[model samples]
Target: MTTAMGAALRRIQLGNALSAFGNGFTIPYLFVYVSQVRNLGASTAGVVLATLAVAALLVLPLTGRVIDRRGPLPVAIAGTVSAAVGSLGLGFADSKVLVVAAAAALGAGFAVIQPALATMIVWCSTPTTRSRAFAMQFFLNNLGLGIGGLLGGQLVDPSNASSFVRLFAIESAMFLVLGVAVATVRLPKAPRLGDVVPAGEGAKGGWRSLLGDRAMVQLCVLGFVMFFACYGQFESGLAAFAVEVTRISPATLGIALAANTAAIVLTQFAVLRLVDGRRRSRVVALVGLIWTVAWIAAGVSGLVPGAHGVATALLISTYALFGIGESMLAPTVAPLVADLAPARLVGQYNSAFALVKQLAMAVGPAVGGLMAGGGMYGAYIVLLIVCALGITALALRLGRRLTPEQDNPRLLARRSEPVAGSAAAPAPVACSASH
Candidate 1:
């Protein structure tokens, strides 16, 4: 990468970390802020949360087309400004209607930001560096959120509504900072919609071309299951099981969550090295195996409920195990999406994948909540375990559809290596996806 590109990526990552820090302040407190602090009932709080999802769904499809047409910079800046307005509105909005509306704006802003930032990273880094770039992004995001949550927790008092307002105001300020930082970034000239698609066809042709890539479609399917099985269960199925079945306290659950983040923050670089030069598909398969054990550990925790100490330890380990799997995925999944995408269509692919994730986040919670709420805890554990194993199956299947260079990018670097005792470069390796 050139110096300019590196500088742009650094600025983007810094801004991303700061924005995530602000988002963290609200994440842990949003439910409480809406349901109790704002004096809105639990039902209203539910609506606010649902509204966020609805807003994302409404925005993501169009977001991709706009990014592809106008470039990620403007899209990213627009998103941050919208998010700032939403965050600031939430700070002072006490009524349920106002809260829900604010959430809609925030959600839409977030939906746009994710794909926009991802495309920017894709543009800034070459394929060889892309995996590490995304890994670093994931690591920073988690670290920022972790610190912000810790400090925000220290400052918040449920009895004082003004404290919550102050938290939201700080969040708004960070978003504006993100917008300013992004505006300073100078991206390489990007392909416009017309450059990628024929004049008359427009966005539909782009979508059709995207859907035609068998590997991408399979990855999207795999993405849904992956998110549904693990991330979907984090605060819903798994937390409920820990509380109701294992009979662990909410405070303990918080500790387990911290363990998850700590595991990611501490081990990310180590895991990055470990997975480097390896096949991304097999790496993802390995993550499935890890999560399989995580789900089983969670199940065992519930079964040994009589021994509270044992149960709590098992549950905490379960979360830590999930964290380890997450570390593995950080370098694999997103890079694969970029590799599959045509260079001109990177934004579209990123947004489509983000849409899939949001769908899983929406559906996973609803299904898990039903199972946990209905006291079908045993079934829930079994279902998630099956989904985990399915991830492995799906990955290996997708591997067959990937070019060697796409599946294992290190081979590209190896192919480009200087031949021993030779002045001239080695012959280019002929690789096939199907082979």
Candidate 2:
């Protein structure tokens, strides 16, 4: 990568870390703050939580169009500002309507930030550097979240409602800071479909164009199941299962989460190396297998009629294994999304995938929670195990659809070397962000 690209990437990563850090303060504590501190009751708090998801669903399609038309930087700035306002508002909202409205703003901002940031990464990095860039993004995200959560825990006081307000104010400040930081970054010009095709030939059909790609469609499906079976369960369904079935203590649950985060921070680079140059689909399939084993371990933790120590060990091991799978996916899935896009449609594709993820996360907890809570623990584990197997099957099929260059990018880099009569590839250029 050129020095300019390097500088741009650093700015982007810094922005990512700041946004994630701010988010950590609210994500882990929102339900508690709303339900207990505000005395809105659990049902109201649940509605507030659901409002975030509903708002994302409402706005994401439009956000994708805006990103595709306007470029990512402006969209990112807008998202951050919206999030800052919503976060600050949330601190003061007492009425149910006000709380939900603030949550809607926060959710819309959060939803847009993802694709905007992802598109910026694509514009900033060459294909050779892209995987590592995304891996670093994942690493910093986890690190920021871990540190933020740790600090947030120290700042929050269950007995004092005002303490929760202080936490929200800090989170809002971080969002504003991130917005200012990223606003200064200069990114490469985004290529549009019009740039690559005849005028009016390809600019008309937006998401319809994206949905036409069979591989992308299948990949979106895979992503949905992947998130549903894993991320969706992390805090809600999985935690409830541990509590009700395995009798896991709160202290042990914290340890398990720490193990997951630690494992990702430590293993992300190493796992990236293992996945680099390999077929991405195969690597994804391997993650599925790893997670299947994780679910089995989770099942064993609950079913084993033995010492408490053994069950705790198994539960922690399950989280660690999930972390390992996450580490592998960090490099594999996101870069593939960028590679699959038609140059100008990167934002649209990214937003579509993000929407799928949100949907999965929204549904996964509810389904997993119901199953685990309704004395259907065995069925819950079995369903996720099947989902894991489905990931493996679908990935192999998707691999068949990808060209050699799409599946193995290292080979693409090697093969792209200048030939005797060929012109050299253009140098990376830095473009100013749109106002």
Candidate 3:
């Protein structure tokens, strides 16, 4: 990379960390701030949460087209400004209507940020460095969230509405800072909508070309299941099971969560090295295996519920194992998304995948909540174990559809194959969707 590109990469990563930190402050506290601190009812708070999802869904399709047309930096700056405004509004809004409206703006902004930054990363890094670039992004993001949450927790007092307001203000400030940070980044010129063969074709063909690709669709399916089985369950299903079945205290749950974050923060680099030269599909498959063990450990924790010490240890182990799977995925799935897209269409592809994730997250909680059912009959454990195993099966299936270049990028690096310019870009894999 050139010196300019290196500086740009650093700025992007720093901006990402700051933005994540800002979100961490507000995201965890939203329900409490809305339902109790703001004196709105639980139903209203739930509406606010749902509004975020709705706004993302409404805006993401449009966002993809705009990114492909206008490039990611402008869109990202716009999103940052929107989020800052929404954060300030949410901080002070007393009425449920205002709260929901603020959430809508925040959600739309959040939706755009993913694809915009992803595209920026693509522009700044060559394929050889892309996986590691994304891994570093993931690591910094988690670190920022953990620290932000810790600080927010320290400053917040449920009894004091002003404390919550102060937290939101701080989050708003972070967003504004991130906006300034992103504005300073200089990206390399790449294909935009205007550069495509036909002026209007890029816009119309963006989603069509993406959806027409069998492998991309399959990967999206696999991604959806991956998120639904794990991330979806983290706070609602798994936490509920720990509390109701394992009979663990809330403090223990906190410890388990801390263990999860700690495991990722500590081990991400090591895991990145391990994944560096391997097939991305195989790394993902390994994540499935790791998470399989995690689910079994989760089951073990609840099996002998009366043994509190044993259950607590096993539960913490479960979270650590999930953390390991997360670490592996950080370098695998995201880079694969970049590799699959036509250079001009990276933003659309990222947006589509992010859409899949949001959908799974939205649905996962409901399914997990139902499955938790106070941990009756071990249903939740059995279901998640199957999901983990399913992840492995799906990964291997997706592997068959991937080009070797897509599956293992390091081979290109090792052979000194050029990873830039139109000639250097690998051809899309030719494979049927039939499974």
TM per candidate: 0.95, 0.96, 0.93
> Please, what are the lDDT tens digits per residue for candidate 1 over residues 111-187?
89999999988888877888899999999999989999998999899999999988999899999998888888877
Candidate 3 stretches greater than 4 Å from native = 192-197, 374-377, 417-435
Shift in Å, residue 95, candidate 3: 0.9
Indicate the TM-score of model 3. Answer: 0.93
Better of 2 and 3 by TM-score: 2
Candidate 3 structure quality by residue, lDDT tens digits, 1-435:
555666777888898898888777877889989999999999999999899988998888878788877889899999988888888889899998899999998888878888898888887777778888899999999899989988889999999988988988888888878777778876656674554535567656888899899999999999999999889999789999888878889988988998998999999999998888899888899889999999999888888877889999999999999988998998889989999988778888889998999899999888888777754538778889999999999999999999888899877776765555736646321211111
Tell me the lDDT of candidate 1.
0.89
Q: What lDDT does candidate 2 reach at residue 150?
A: 91
Poorest lDDT segment (10 consecutive residues) of candidate 1: 426-435
Show model 2 residue runs off by greater than 4 Å: 192-204, 419-423, 431-435
Screening candidate 3 with a backbone cut-off below 3 angstroms (N, C-alpha, C), the clashing residue pairs are none
Local error of candidate 3 at 292, Å? 0.7
The lDDT of each candidate is: 0.89, 0.87, 0.85
For residue 314, give model 2's deviation from the true position in Å.
Answer: 0.8
**Best-matching candidate per TM-score:** 2
lDDT at residue 83 of model 3 (Cα atoms): 82
Model 2, position 399: C-alpha lDDT score: 95
